[model samples]
Target: MPYDVEKPDEQWRAELSPSEYAVLRQAATEPAFTGEYTDTRTEGVYSCRACGAELFTSGTKFESHCGWPSFYDPKDTDAVELVEDRSHGMVRTEVRCARCGSHLGHVFEGEGYPTPTDQRYCINSISLRLQPTDG
Candidate 1:
């Protein structure tokens, strides 16, 4: 899914914080562990607080200890878009919301974790909201 008509600057300002605007709208990343969801382990789907798009599930989370919220996979395959991130001094895959294009984080392969999926999705804490399911 692609982003729809953008909200006006005034409306965006009223809805989002400076950092939220920078990351969620402008595609910036907050520093590790400083975000709201890095240490969260609620039993729910993590959705886009801005648009309610399901991005992650609590089940895939692991204590990566990488200072950011880490996941092995997304809750839905269509929830995100991955692009080649050639920024900084390394090559990484930049992860974003497929619907709203929110800056989620980076995905790296082959970290040698003990899991079957040797992938680490180091994500921004501010980009997600825990919506616990009625189990």
Candidate 2:
């Protein structure tokens, strides 16, 4: 799919760190419980690290103990784009930033989480840049 912010491969590599590039650009996963936002509770807006597009808000975040920062919903319906992932011998939904198409992570549904949507947007923290709300 086409994205609003399109950068060349070289530019993306230069802009993002090694880990960030691996996840955001190459669709790689970070180690469980190792992300900066994995256990964070600070109120903020989580934006795409690559394009600065607002993806999820702290209000939608929930503790799913899935090793990544999980959100029940995106900040807006158009904030993300979901694609079918059929890797690792399983079918799952992959979430990407709508603005840049950078891979954020995967979203799982029907697992009986207490969230209103029952959907867990298990996102990689390296894929996000949190902007804390003003006190």
Candidate 3:
């Protein structure tokens, strides 16, 4: 699928930090419990760090103690894209920013979460930038 914001490899590298580029572009996972938003409870929207596309919101975020920021749903149905990941000798659903195709994280389901959706969108903090809502 073609993305709304597409850029060359060099451009992406130049824009994102080393760690951000790894998770957002190379599909690498950050260390568990080490992300900036793992325990964030502020009211805001989380947008894709690479392209500023809104992906998840604070309303959908929950504490799963899984080390990464977890959300039961995205800000919108079309805000993200899921792909079948067969890497690391296992199968999982990988999530990406729909607008830029930057790797966000993985989504899991059927774990018995107490949210409207039983799904969990485990996203990398480096892949996101939080915009706090003002009163």
Per-candidate TM-scores read: 0.88, 0.99, 0.99
lDDT per residue for candidate 2 within 21-130, as digits (tens), equals 99999999999999999999999999999999999999999999989999999999999999999999999999999999999999999999999999999999999999
Q: Stretches of candidate 1 above 4 Å error?
A: 4-10
Number of backbone-clashing residue pairs for each candidate, in the order shown: 0, 0, 0
Candidate structures ordered by lDDT, highest first: 3, 2, 1
lDDT values, one for every candidate? 0.81, 0.96, 0.97
The 10-residue segment with the lowest total lDDT in model 3 = 1-10
Query: What lDDT is reached at residue 122 by model 3?
Result: 97
The 10-residue segment of model 2 with minimum total lDDT is: 1-10
**How accurate locally is residue 65 in candidate 1, as Cα lDDT from 0 to 100?**
89
Q: After superposition, how far is residue 29 of candidate 2 from its true place, in Å?
A: 0.2
With candidate 1 superimposed using the best TM-score fit, by how many Å does residue 65's alpha carbon deviate from the native?
0.3
